[model samples]
Target: MTELHIRAATPEDLDTVLAFWKVAAEGTSISDDSGGVERLVARDPEALILAERGGELAGTVIAGFDGWRCHLYRLAVHPDHRRQGIASALLAAAEERFVRLGGRRADAMVLTRNETAHQAWGAAGYGPEEQWRRWVKPLTDQVCSAARPDCSG
Candidate 1:
């Protein structure tokens, strides 16, 4: 196995990362588009970490920290690179970033149906929080109406 190189992704990496996710990642996300990822890279250049082996993308992990919370997402290892410590390497880089940024705890969004991921995360010292549930609403450009007072223009 070749040496693994970990680094922060740049604008040039957005397209490649998007394409890689389709093949390596477990599921799709609302923010999987180029625009969304571009915004992420722009907001925090170090948030998207990539692991490359012999110049080929081997794994990726988004270690986003919104000042108060550390959120991990899109942890994907190439099918050919599984069980080779790629995920662990990417996560170590992510955790190191979070700690440097003053983040206390890191949380990951793992799909409930992805049993393989459950085991991986569990082995990485992450477990499901039974008391907390995730709730989300996709933001859109549609104008807010009087009936939906919760939405603002």
Candidate 2:
């Protein structure tokens, strides 16, 4: 069995994390915006978790917390690292970290068409919940702008 080290991600790990998410199953939108990750890193570096084997990244999971509940996202394992417990270890570590941060209850969103992911999540103690619909609006021509200040200027 290949030994693995699971730990919170650092800004230096974004490239590796992006590479891992590149091979994720279809319909999964996991962190396409590097700028977003940069912001997330600034807010909470520990939310990103990774598994390393032989000093190489083997798996990754982005875990976020909002005090009441913790959220899991962008879980991926190197094809060569699958079945080696790297993903599981990363997940367990993420959950433990969430608990350490005083979070209760964890949640994750998987694409509806991802049957393989469904099975894995089920095996990991997640169950089928009510159907969820997703909505997205294209911001192709729009730029993210800060809310206007109400102060009289």
Candidate 3:
């Protein structure tokens, strides 16, 4: 196996990143399109981090800092490359980024039903925030019915 290298994603990497997430990630997001990713990279070039080995993508993590808080998303490792510390490497890079940006706390949006991912986050020293709930409103009809009054499926 080739040595793992972690680095910030470039504009040219957007398509590859999207494709990688479809296979490696647990769930999908409304903003997972090319346009959304392009906007993200344009706004914050250092937010999206990637792990590569022998020119193949091994893992990905998005470390977004919105002035006061650090938000992590899409922390995915390819199944073939699991248990090889790729996730840890990506997270280390993210944490380092957060610290450099004056971010005191980091929060990740992990799926509740993903038990394996829960264990991974736990192993990485992150505990679940039982008191907190994620309230969301999808802007796109593809994810939620914007035409409906309550947006219920």
Residues 50-124 of candidate 3: C-alpha lDDT, one tens digit per residue:
999999999999999999999999999999999999999999999999999999999999888889999999999
lDDT to native, each model: 0.90, 0.72, 0.90
Candidate 1 has which clashing residue pairs, if any?
A: none
Cα lDDT tens digits for candidate 1, 1-153: 799999999999999999999899986776778888999999999999999999988899999999999999999999999999999999999999999999999999988878999999998999999999887655765534555543311
Best-to-worst ranking by TM-score: 3, 1, 2
Model 3: runs farther than 4 Å from truth?
145-153
The regions of model 1 sitting more than 4 angstroms off are 141-153
Report residue 11 deviation for candidate 1 (angstroms). Answer: 0.5
For every model shown, what is its TM-score relative to the native structure? Answer: 0.91, 0.81, 0.92
TM-score of decoy 1:
0.91
RMSD of each: 5.6, 8.0, 3.6
Error of 1 at 108 (Å): 0.3
Candidate 3, poorest ten consecutive residues by summed lDDT: 144-153
Clashes of each: 0, 0, 0
